[model samples]
Target: MIAWMMLAQAALLGLLGAGVTVAGIAKVRMNDWILGAAAIATLTLVVQIVASIIAPFTGSGPTGDPFEYWVYLVMAVLIPPAVALWALIDKGRWGVVALGVALMSVGVMVYRMHQIWFVQVF
Candidate 1:
C-alpha cells in the first residue's frame, strides 16, 4: 500500500470503529448513517482491488507472501457488507456489537496485512 492508501484505510477503520462503538454502546439500531459507512467501505474495497493489481509494479507491494496479504484483503473487503447483512438479520444491541466487532476486526486485519506486506523490511 502507498501512503494515501494507508491513510484512507486508517480513516475507514476509525470511522467504522467509532461509529459502531458508539452505536453499540448507546444501544442504537442499525441505521442509514452506518449503511453509508458500509457503502464507503465497499468503495474502499474497490480501491483495494485496484491497488492490489498495481502494487507490484509500484514496488510498494508485499515483500512477504502475497497470500497472507490477500487473505486479509479478502476479509477487509467482506467485513462491512457482511456485518450489515448480519445486523439486518438479527437486530439489537448484539447487532450493533457485531458491527463494532467487525470494524475492530478490520483494524486488526489492516495492521496485520501491513505487517505481512512489509515483513521483509523489518
Candidate 2:
C-alpha cells in the first residue's frame, strides 16, 4: 500500500504497455524483450500480492474494503499468465497483440491497486 511503490508500478506498466503496442505495430515477431517485459509485469503483480497479504498486519488497512481487494487480486494473478499462454499458442502478430492487451491490463491493475489501497470508495 505504499503510495510511491504503487505509482512506480503503474508507471512501469504504462511504459511496458506502450512498448508492447509499438512493437506489435511495427510487425515485430516474438522476441526476448517482449517476454522480459511480461516477466517483469508478472513479478510486479506477485510483489503486489505479497504486499496485499502483509498490508493489514503492517497497518496498511483493509485496502479500501474487501470486495475491491479480492477483485484486484483475482485479475492481477490470472490475466498475465493466461494472456502469455494464449499468445504462445500462436506464432504471429496476434500473439504480440495479446501481449499488448495483457500489458494494458497490468497497467489498469496497478491503478486499481492504488485506488483500493488509498481511495475511500470503489
Candidate 3:
C-alpha cells in the first residue's frame, strides 16, 4: 500500500469517473476511452497488488491491518474488469452506466486503500 501509488490511483480514478459521467450525460458512447481507462485501471491495480506483496519482505511490513487492506485490494482488482466486460457485451447506454459505476467504484477503492495504509483507524 504505497501512499504515492494510492494517491496516483485516486487521481486517475477521479478523472476517469468524471470523463465517464460527462460522456454519459452527453449521450456519447465513447467506448474507446472507457476501454482504455479500464485497461489502465487494471494495470494499476496489478502493480499495486505486486507492490503490496513485496512490501512486507522489503522491510515495510504491515503498514496497517492486512485484512482490511486485502478487502480493498480485492474489490479494486475485481470490480473494474467485471464491469468492463459486461459493458462490452451489453450494447446500450447501460454499458456506459456500468463503466461509470466501475470508475466511481475505483475512486472509492483508492480512498479505501489510502485509509487502510495511512489513517490507522479502520
TM-score of each prediction: 0.86, 0.89, 0.88
Q: State the TM-score for model 1.
A: 0.86
Give per-residue CA lDDT, model 1, range 1-122, as digits (tens). Answer: 76457556866776787878788779888788766777777677768768887988977777879987898888788988888898888878778778777776776677677777778686
Which prediction has more favorable lDDT, 1 or 2?
A: 2
Ranking by TM-score: 2, 3, 1
Give the per-residue lDDT of model 2 (tens digit) for 33-71: 888888888898888777777877887676366687778
| Residue pairs whose backbone atoms clash in candidate 3 | none
Q: Write down the RMSD of candidate 3 (Cα, Å).
A: 2.1
Candidates' lDDT values, in order? 0.77, 0.78, 0.79
Name the runs in model 1 displaced over 4 angstroms.
none
Best by TM-score: 2
Measured by lDDT, the strongest candidate is 3
Clashes of each: 0, 0, 0
| Clash count, candidate 1 | 0
